[model samples]
Target chain A: MYYRALGFQKDYAWASHDDIPFSPPKIPLSQATVALVTTAVVDASIPKPVREANSYPIVDVPDHFDTSELSWDKETTHTKDRESYFPINDLRARELRQEFKALAPRFHFVPTEYSQRHTIETDAPLITRHCLEDAVDLAILIPL
Target chain B: MTARTLEAAGIATVVIGSALDILRTAGTPRVIFNDLPLGNPVGKPFDRDMQHRTVSAAFELLFSAEAPGAVKTLPHQWSTQDAWRENFMAVRAEDAATLEALGRATQATRLENKAKGLFRR
Candidate 1:
């Protein structure tokens, strides 16, 4: 749909795989360390231009990050409310409720790219390395 | 794709998204699909209760999903009717020219970024 809308000659080929990865939680939700990864670039405006993957300390996460440059359903909705997409506060409240043990020290920001190879081979490994370094037991991905 | 990679690397993962068709084929381990606008997947902006509920549901799927490729569709809707779906990313005839130019510029930027090795670890 997006490809056609963007005037591409053929529909974009979304990556598909037969050997889907599966890993059961190693720790109970009450004790697991959680991390967040989103498609929202951090502190980037249209002029600043973020075309790479990055991570920031969760405590340093902005109340709002720029999304005006990203592609989404801008007609019906807006990203003014950070909690609507980022949900750092909501996850913090959950941590207090003992829903999870703790939030990882850092949250990740991955750019939206057309190349699945870059995502699987480059970006994913970078995020996975960060998760391991933070000792994150579970990760929740929220893409805008 | 990151979820799949993370899970393969021994960390459990769950996705909260609004694009069902894309998520379905992406081979994600666990997903909570919200039938809302693209930008507001967790819930409507400023609606704290809805946002909390959506996150809670994603956690539920995380704990309960026994196999890979598990997906649960939340009952939330963007509106009373399905009008939003019809207009979602719908290209307008007048906007075609602008979109084409924007697309070309975006491709050029991507190529420049790639050459710079911006995403390489």
Candidate 2:
């Protein structure tokens, strides 16, 4: 579907070996602070300068941000519908239900136009630092 | 890279995306690959129940996945091929002319905003 969205068909090589490593949750989710992150280009609800930085900028999840730029049909997810990609509201609902100990103070939004190199080199570091600074115990990264 | 780095830093993370193959290659520790459309991974966009389920299911793996690079698929189907095409084909052929024009205009604005770091972040 992603390739079709880009109007093309291509082969993607999958890793035969599960090379990615994992770390168990340092603390139980019931006692951890959780955060949400996405590469959906959701509206930042901030100034243009801050939003358009040449380098990746970890911005706050704006209240009622627009999800139009996302690859999905905007008609369904307009400004009001965010669960399509940014599920902060769902996460919050879970929190209200005591699904987790607490919600991170902020959520993160990254542009979809970033190059893989940029994402690995620039965005990854900033995102890592931001998560660490926020003391995020668990994170949900929804890629578009 | 972000997920791997964060997990390496001792922060548990889960990736919920459609491109499971790409994500697996990228080495996402915990992944819940929903075979849904790109933008509507949580479900059919506005359906609160589906979105909530998707989120809940993804979070469930944070504890269930035992090994590094664990990947799982949710048993939810977006549609029975009747309405699924609407997602697969973003714009219908009949409405191409009209929608394409509007899309071009919107794209211009988005590009300008992106260059200026405005609009969607």
**Model 2: per-residue Cα lDDT over A66-125, one tens digit each:** 555456544333435566777877777778888798887766665554345555666666
What is the C-alpha lDDT profile of model 2 across B20-89, one tens digit per residue?
7778777789898888766666676588887787888877899899998888888877667646545554
- Model 1 spans > 4 angstroms off: A45-50, B92-121
Clashing pairs in 1: none
Give the worst 10-residue stretch by lDDT in candidate 2 chain B.
B82-91
Summarize candidate 1's per-residue lDDT along B87-113 as a digit string, tens digits: 777778887887778778867886787
- Candidate whose lDDT is highest: 1
**Which candidate tops DockQ?**
1
Runs of candidate 2 exceeding 4 Å displacement: A1-18, A42-60, A73-80, B82-121
Provide the lowest-lDDT 10-residue window in model 2 chain A.
Answer: A49-58
- TM-score to true structure, per model: 0.90, 0.72
